[model samples]
Target: MGIDACTSRPFRGSEAVARGEVSWGRLAGPAFRPLLTDVYVGSSAEVDTATWVRAVALWGRGAGVVAGPLAARAWEAECPWEERELIMPTSRRETSDEIDVRRDRLLPDEVCFRYGVAVTSPARTAFDLARRGPLVEAVAAVDAVAFRCGLTSAHLLAVAAAHPGARGSVQVRRVVALMDPRAESLMETRLRLVFILRGVPAPVPQYEVRVRDGGLRWLDLAWPRVPAGRRKLGLEYDGPEHRTITGQNRDLLRDADLDDQEWEILHIGAVQVFDERRADQLAARVMRRLNPDP
Candidate 1:
């Protein structure tokens, strides 16, 4: 297409050539980048999650419904993967290394439109993830979308119940059972999973502790019902926000107040989340603190 015709929007590579707005050779040039196979995005266009989702629709046509991370992203949920996922009914099959296609059946209601592109509903996205993803990741994904979409474990469970005999249904149920809507961050969800997987009793999320001055402090994870009476334990994931001087000073005084309240606080960072062994060790330490005699 002519530079003027590009208009900072995604268009089909064939459409550009057919309309004579641009040559086939120019279509392959740096002025445009491929968002999906045969789908090109103008270099000047803003390519974001919405653009990517809409671009896939151009290639998919009637082949499938956008599912998985793409669907989750369309629902405005934070999905970790960069690749797009589509679900084609068993009747249709398409091939692409760039896109992950799931051949499965979807109820009419499970499919809906977001940003003008057909995608899995929030409930279905969580269901698909729990059914197909690894246990921990499935839980995290479910937590993220559920939190973003204002869904609850009941919503995910209802979707799971609708798809009986589906692959990983048992595992999906287990994940839904453990998912908590109060988790506001991926790291917080992951940290909760670590504690659960290690056989430690789950801590209350966003737990509030009253300070001496009457102001309340909320903790990321807190356990007040430990085995040995009222020994309160709090766990915090120090994300980038904690790196600033203001954040540090506030945390110093907050921790001091928690200390005064006889609370044992444990802090972990992003680096600990990626190390499975270390994460488990940290959870083990917390478990020891929660149950000093056990």
Candidate 2:
């Protein structure tokens, strides 16, 4: 297992390209040694690897995959949108052998890397991990490979046809058609997963609601789950950055509209999101709203 640069924690699947064959040696400047574990720092030839792409792929792991931008960048594939995180591939599928020592595990539906190590055909890669990735990132990768890198959606569609019933294939097709890479955010994806893991019905994300005074308002999550014919919300993650003085007033007015609509909102702040009491607070509120008795 190689250590992640960010966490320094040992990851499960990192494999050095040539066991101990390469190291920070013979550099003209600073003196350094390999860390007690795996990572090395402070040498200019410091980063002796080919590139970030090769470093990650040539030795990536579980939390690491042929990741989105890195994957495209590896082949000098042009990118259509900026990226949020590096995408890594898993070595689960048999294709790991076919994908090059550094590629990812993929379903026949989601990916297709050549012997040359270029990205897989578009539809295949998208279908493979579109749902797993933050949605926008997923779409951006698709755009990077398709519109920018010259792989076409029609070609990807044909690939999907060959892998019928691939878990995320159909959704991948929809995203291919509707993903507006121009206006998507990674935060929305995290919130969606939060709700999913909490067992709350998914919200209509980025829904625009008009205020009584004619200003436009966008919601992080719009309660789409109808219970007793009302869109009552069980909880809300209210980070302070968005709840500053100006933000507070807007939220107050928005809450008024939501309250009028019979929705109960539980505001969760950054502290609450990470605090010890968060789980208890969220559970109590969600249950209180979902099944109440006088």
Candidate 3:
């Protein structure tokens, strides 16, 4: 009867019409916003994680199981939100604008229920995304799920080992090998990968540094095993969050304190990550620091 039932949650248009709570004509009007083909949310409601999960329920129609990035999102793993991805073992069919449907089967233990919708387990979701494409993002996706789900590299390797001939299995192995639980952001993972792929010594993530004022600070990327008397190097990705005055002031203080403790800190932003030249220069700078001339 009220928008609360529909907008506050994901509801099928047909469900409301069949219950006589609303006329078919009313369901198609401005009062409701379409989430998928037959799914609608309250027009006034803000679409968020819960809404996305509910939309998955309506779109799935009890047949498909949520997979890929949507499953990762449901598990609270960090990833970009583009569209809802679903997989049904029933048949191979064309995908609709509402969601992506793949004709793939999951093992009995690979599916679980979350947000009132059937979804791939965290490990399964990580494996699925790792096999899906662009290696760097896939690696970041797996790292995120592992970090949040308390999964280890062994778990990811075990999952990869189970699917011998699966597509991207090799990439999955590579991603597992590079997975780091301490990585807290996609940019950090990407930057780390850049160093590895560039044949530079990989830095420790979330390394602890003792500040001059007795406070503890964590470095995003650090060469902590440098010689006892030699200074250590660190690289930090400064995203949009660091652009504000408060953030900048905090960073300045943190940098000064770390500098006093023999840390050679380098700061980069989103632009450096996207530009190949900038990324290469950063890698070279790190390498030079790691293996400085006599």
Whole-model Cα lDDT of every candidate shown, in order: 0.82, 0.47, 0.81
Query: Could you tell me which 10 consecutive residues in candidate 3 have the lowest summed lDDT?
Result: 1-10
- The full ranking of all candidates by lDDT, starting with the best, is 1, 3, 2
Each model's backbone clash number: 2, 16, 1
**TM-score of the candidate numbered 3?**
0.94
Against the true structure, what is every candidate's RMSD?
Answer: 2.4, 10.8, 1.8
**Which of 2 and 3 is ahead in TM-score?**
3
lDDT by residue for model 2 over 1-294, one digit each (tens)? Answer: 322233222211213324442333321124333321233333323342123433343333323445444455443444433332223454443323223333334554454353223344455444443544555456545554554445666666666677677667656776566433222333444444444446655556556666566666566556645556445663455765656899788778778876655665656655543443665565455644555354
In model 2, the Cα lDDT at residue 49 comes to 17
Best by TM-score: 3
Model 2 gets an lDDT of 0.47
**Model 2 alpha-carbon miss at residue 183, Å:** 11
Model 3 lDDT per residue over 1-294, tens place: 544434677788788888877777777788888878878887888888768876886777778788888788898888854658888878766568778877876888888999788898888888887886688888888878887898888877777777778888888877887889888877888888889878998788889887878899998888886755668888888988889999899999999999898888889877667788987987887777777467
Evaluate model 2: give its TM-score.
0.43
Rank by TM-score, descending? 3, 1, 2
Worst 10 residues of 2 by lDDT: 6-15
1-294: candidate 1 lDDT, tens digit per residue = 274334556678887788887777877777788777788877778888888888877777756788888888898877666668888877666778888776888889899998777899989998987776667777888888988889898888888778889888999878878888788777888888888888989989899999888889999989877775646889999988899999899899999999888898888887677898898888888877777574
